[model samples]
Target: MAEGFLRHLAGDRFDVASAGTDPVGLNPGAVEAMKEVGVDIARQESKKVDRFLGQRFDYVITVCDRAKEACPTFPWAQSLLHWSFDDPAAAEGRAEERRAVFRRVRDEIAQRIRRFMARERKANKDPAQ
Candidate 1:
């Protein structure tokens, strides 16, 4: 859902990319939840965080606790934010329940991303003195 939120704010100020420590493929439930909100992440593939090590990033944000624990140090990152989220893939119970979990996570990610973008825009407009 981070990707979805980024796409929603595309062509704006933020350049966003999401990668995982293990680099597993995109979750189907995640795709469906995003589709419900008019964001198509069906073609977005999982990426390894190592792929971005050579480049510079203003910030590196991890969305899961496990990823935060295992996050690699990005030499050029100005900041690293840990917004730990529940592992929707690990949700148990019926299929619907699992989907519900994914939807909740997706919504939470979207909301957080929106807030982050707003804060970032404000900061860029007025850097600390």
Candidate 2:
């Protein structure tokens, strides 16, 4: 969801990709939640962090506590950040209840992405930052 929001909000200004320590494939609830807000993430794959180990990135961010602990270090990245969000996919309940959790997390991720973008923009404007 973070990847979807970042891609949607940043457009071509940033290149974004997301992977997990344990790749469980994309969740249907996530796809539905993103679609509610006009972002289509159905095409995004559930990748393993290993796939990106050889690549360099400007920022390496982890969106969950478990991933933050298990994720390998990207020492070359300019910024390494963690945004601890609940794993909505882990939410247990009926269909609508699970969808509600997805929606809540989706909104939280969107808000965080907007804040991150604002800070990035400000930093770009101020060389000292």
Top TM-score prediction, candidate number: 2
Tens digits of lDDT, candidate 2, 66-102: 9999999998788899999999989999999999999
Write model 1 residue lDDT over 1-129, tens digit each, in one string: 786678776545567688989987988888898899889889887999888887898888888989988988887888988897899999999999999999999888988988887787687784531
Error of 1 at 45 (Å): 1.4
- Looking at model 2, the pairs that clash are none
RMSD of 1: 3.1
> Given candidate 1, what's the lDDT at residue 112?
91
Number of the top lDDT candidate: 2
TM accuracy, model 1: 0.90
- Please, what is the whole-model Cα lDDT of each candidate in the order they appear? 0.84, 0.92
Off by over 4 Å in 2: 126-129
Q: Judge candidate 1 against the unseen true structure and give its global Cα lDDT, from 0 to 1.
A: 0.84
